[model samples]
Target: MIPIKIPREEKLEIIANIQNHFYREMSDEIGDLAAENLLDFMLKELSPHIYNQAIKDARTTVEQKMMALEEDLYALEKPIR
Candidate 1:
């Protein structure tokens, strides 16, 4: 699998958020490098699962639409004598 490469701007934002969370929630300070490493770790470990779940969700939605379309087509049939 290809590595997730976040843009520098967005990565900086995420690192800031992580540092803030550590300070507020854990009352511990996290350095910029530590926060960035944590972010990279999460992306590597969690992104594949998240991406797979999203594909599953989209597939389910398409299946539902197909089923509804089939039913609608049946409704359009004329009654036979």
Candidate 2:
């Protein structure tokens, strides 16, 4: 599968969030590079599980919709005399 490409603006926002979280919550100061590195590591290690779960959710949704569609089609059939 092709690797996911984060938009530049969103990437910057995420990096900023990482830096802010470390500073505010952990009482640790980290630079932009450090924050960016952390974000990259998370994307590499954590994103796969999240991506898989999202795929599963989408598949379930589609399956339910398909079942509903089948039911509708069955409802539309005329009864034989």
Candidate 3:
């Protein structure tokens, strides 16, 4: 799978959130660089699993819609004399 690439501004926002989480929860101050590195690591390691789950969700939704469409089409069929 291709690497997930987040826009620079969004990446910055995520890094800031990570830093804040660490500071608030862990009571440890993390620098911007450290936060960025951690973000990169997480994106690399976790993105594929997340992407696969999203695909599964989309497939299930499409299958359900297709079944509904099939029922609608069957309802429109003319009755045999």
Candidate 4:
């Protein structure tokens, strides 16, 4: 759960690491079978959990950012404009 904002290229590298370390441990055929199972698990179980958590986190972060932006805008505005 490290929250790091990375560029798209770095994200791909992270994904490659995940696949190489975790998924690639199995044989190709077995990995394919497991991938289908993993996809089903994600759709049925993992996705809801991830989606809900992400939504909650995003809402909080966006709210905080919006408030900060509003404060900055107010500070920057010209009087009686």
Candidate 5:
């Protein structure tokens, strides 16, 4: 076993730097994991629901527009087809 003689002030500074680096890395890792989980949940649960609602809304709007256009066309006098 090698005997280590670290001065108190130097030891404190080294410890502080090591702790800061550790916490920074940990925070980054946790943030990435959280973002990935959130994206996965949104894709799995929320995206499909939102996509379906948008489709339903689009269909309703298209049908209403078609109906209105048909009525307008009927009101116009048509030339010989």
Candidate 6:
């Protein structure tokens, strides 16, 4: 799998959030560079699992829609004389 590359703006936002959470919850001050490194590590470790789950979700949705379409097509069948 290709490495997941987050947009620069979004990455910055997430890093800021991580920094805030550390300060609020852990009472630890994390610098911007530390937060960015942490974000990079998390994305590398977690993105593949997240990507797989998203694909599974999309496949389920498509299967349900296909079933519904089949039912609708069956309802349109003409009765034999």
* Candidate number of the best lDDT: 1
Candidates ranked, most accurate by lDDT first:
1, 3, 6, 2, 5, 4
Worst 10 residues of 4 by lDDT: 27-36
Report clashes for each candidate as comma-separated counts: 0, 0, 0, 0, 0, 0
The per-model lDDT (C-alpha) reads: 0.97, 0.90, 0.96, 0.64, 0.64, 0.95
Q: Per-residue CA lDDT of candidate 2, range 1-71, in tens?
A: 44568999999999999988998999999999988888888888877888999999999999999999999
lDDT of 3 by residue, 4-49 (tens): 9899999999999999999999999999999999999999999999
Q: What tens digits encode model 5's per-residue C-alpha lDDT throughout 1-81?
A: 123445767755555555556568775333444544444554567666777799999999999999999999988967886
Q: Tell me the lDDT of candidate 4.
A: 0.64
| Best candidate according to TM-score | 3
Instruction: Put down candidate 6 lDDT per residue, 1-81, tens digits, no spaces.
Output: 898888999999999999999999999999999999999899899999999999999999999999999999999999999
Which candidate order results from sorting by TM-score in descending order? Answer: 3, 6, 2, 1, 5, 4
* Candidate 2 ranges with C-alpha deviation above 4 Å: none
What TM-score does candidate 1 get on C-alpha atoms? 0.88
Model 6 Cα RMSD, Å?
A: 0.9
List candidate 6 stretches off by more than 4 Å. none
Clashing pairs in 4: none
lDDT (C-alpha) at residue 59 in model 5: 100
TM-score of each: 0.88, 0.92, 0.96, 0.47, 0.53, 0.94
Per-residue lDDT for 24-55 in model 4, tens only? 57533334445445544545665667778999
- Candidate 3, superposed: residue stretches over 4 Å from native: none
**How many pairs of residues in model 6 come into backbone collision?**
0
